[model samples]
Target: MAALYVLLAMILVVLLSPLLTPFNTSTQFSDAIALPPSWVESGNMNYLFGTDDLGRDMLSRLLIGGLYSLGLPILMVAVSSLIGMSIGALAGIDRTIKYQSLSRLFDTLLSIPSFLMALIIIAILGTGFNNVAFAITLSLIPQFIFVTRNAVHEEWHKDYVTASRLNGCSKAYLLYRVILPNVTPTLVMQLTVSLSVAIMDIAALSFLGLGIQAPTPEWGSMLARSLDEVYLSPWSMVLPGITLFITIMAINIVGDSLRRALKERVNS
Candidate 1:
């Protein structure tokens, strides 16, 4: 329950941050560069979180960066899940040559770690936002496909499925009316897996300088750029790191709680 509230608060803050930001994320304060958080002797009251090495306000940037860290992954998961569920479900329903080939290919791809897969794709596609987004989204799709395909395939062998087929139920009807409801929990569970991977992938790619570029207000890049300034201003690193930790933790707890609830409901 607490985790859910924290997640909601983070979402709300991310959504409303633009209006709440006190300074332009890019604006530099020449005189106020590298100050610590307010209350520190060297810190300025005007800059509550102080300024970064570039003199940009930390609080403003943190608020804005939450969007990229939290937002882009949501988009990535949506895209990957839609495409993956489609391909995976088709592969589950149709054991044809083409689908088999595609499924085998995904199996091979899944053997490679998602971050490594993203890196390999990025190597071919090059850096920058579009390429990184494409790379992460594509890397994540295989997991969805694998999970969804397995879930759907399991349903196909069930006694109920066989009975439905014997009753002359169409493939579409079986899929929508029978298979989907049974496998819905499994599919929804994969959502958390995809979301967690997406968040980590974006952060890692950005940290390595392959994801969202500088001045983009992304948590990962903020962490990367702030690394050297840690001694001078630890908040630069601590803020983003803590935020990432909290966000990921909240997601996992909520996802686990949801999975349990759905399983109980299905059993009941």
Candidate 2:
């Protein structure tokens, strides 16, 4: 199911790439600014989703915008998952207060509101794709650590873990060879869920002008820039918003399915 979700998203992005993204992402065709969806405007075949106040194609902007909105989250998720899973696996195998202490530090992080954390980070780092990713990664790492930590803790208690330890397996071998395999399913499920949140968070940051910036074709920033003219060109708002919704919804559906399957497998 997770595979299905990923496949669907990749296929959608690929199919939409040429038709959806801005023809010249950096160039501004001001003459076409604020045009309505082709269906709304007579004799205009271009701008299927309409144009922004700058006459930019809404559909094109949406397409390119999705690249950032989706791209950042996917990157963050991959980085965080690797780090988090490793940390968690080690903590579980070590079974020491140090791991608990490390986990506690992340718990303190979890106490702060995610948007507030991102805002604070942005305030220091300033707005850019890298800054936004850093801010979100900081906010999200704790979840990965916590989930991986707990999953590892449970795996450590399994019979095979004890058998591996007693069989004179090295610490590294026990973690990599024995524990890592057992925890992968849980880790993958967590990644799916975390990826969804990452997507939503970055979009929110872009909406606030603290992420991706203008003229680069990001959904949040596009929506932010378009909100003022929603009445004039509803597609300006609708197109980006719908894309964000669909992407998040698709991620969630996949995450939920993965979670259910993992739970069922564990039970069985």
Candidate 3:
């Protein structure tokens, strides 16, 4: 099944991360530079996927780079989702003009393209993982905000929310206890979609040289580096490109399934 393959791939990456990364990929070894894949080399386990022009182990770099690539987006999506959801929930609890004004501003923000917004942020803040996370979070905040605001607004109009308010529940308690739980199914689906988008955006930024720097293992940077020797060792491009593709595909598939399941449950 597709799920089984994805699960297996996920497990393989996590379990093999430590073992797969070469012990000293930084050490220069010109003699081994641009070696073909192991399939082409007899009695050579050193370069499983082969070596780059700098003789860096492709397999090792893939693991370390993948860790960097995946980790940033995961953290960015989580923090942004929490922040956006909180703001949206608070805005929905308002019965006045101020809340509606804030909600409209959030809607305006959602209208901007995330990539352009992130590009501007990166241009202002500079590169590195922290900057990447900041850009990604900012770019995705509107999505979570919109989802949470709408969910809370709908829940606020429901009988249960009115009943809670009648029972002397404070706005804070009502939002946390009554509104949040009801909206969680929706939130999960939103988060999953946001996470996938964040990952793609992070990778795009890195590919454009506005994200993670060189000598630091990252899927996009690796792809960028491979271009020079791509003609000589096509595997240089093939391996890292495949790695990025598979990881993104796996995340997307999982997210799509979650979204479908959540919608079905809500409808039922």
Number of the top lDDT candidate: 1
In candidate 2, what are the lDDT values of residues 4-51, reduced to their tens digit?
766487547845776756476665577776777777635257667766
* Model 2, total clashes: 4
The Cα local distance difference test for each model comes to 0.90, 0.76, 0.80
Model 1, span 1-268: residue lDDT tens: 9999999999899999999999999999999889898978878899998889999999999999988888878888999999999899889989999998999899899899999999999999898888988999999889989988999899999999999999999988988899988787788778987788889999999999999999898999999999899998899999889999999999988888888888888779
TM-score of each: 0.95, 0.87, 0.87
Number of backbone collisions per candidate? 0, 4, 1
Off by over 4 Å in 3: 1-20, 41-43, 263-268
RMSD of each: 1.4, 2.8, 2.7
What C-alpha lDDT does candidate 3 achieve relative to the native structure? 0.80
lDDT of 3 by residue, 117-233 (tens): 899899999988788878888989888888988889999989989999999999999998888866877888787678768877877888889988888878888788878888987
TM-score quality measure for candidate 2: 0.87
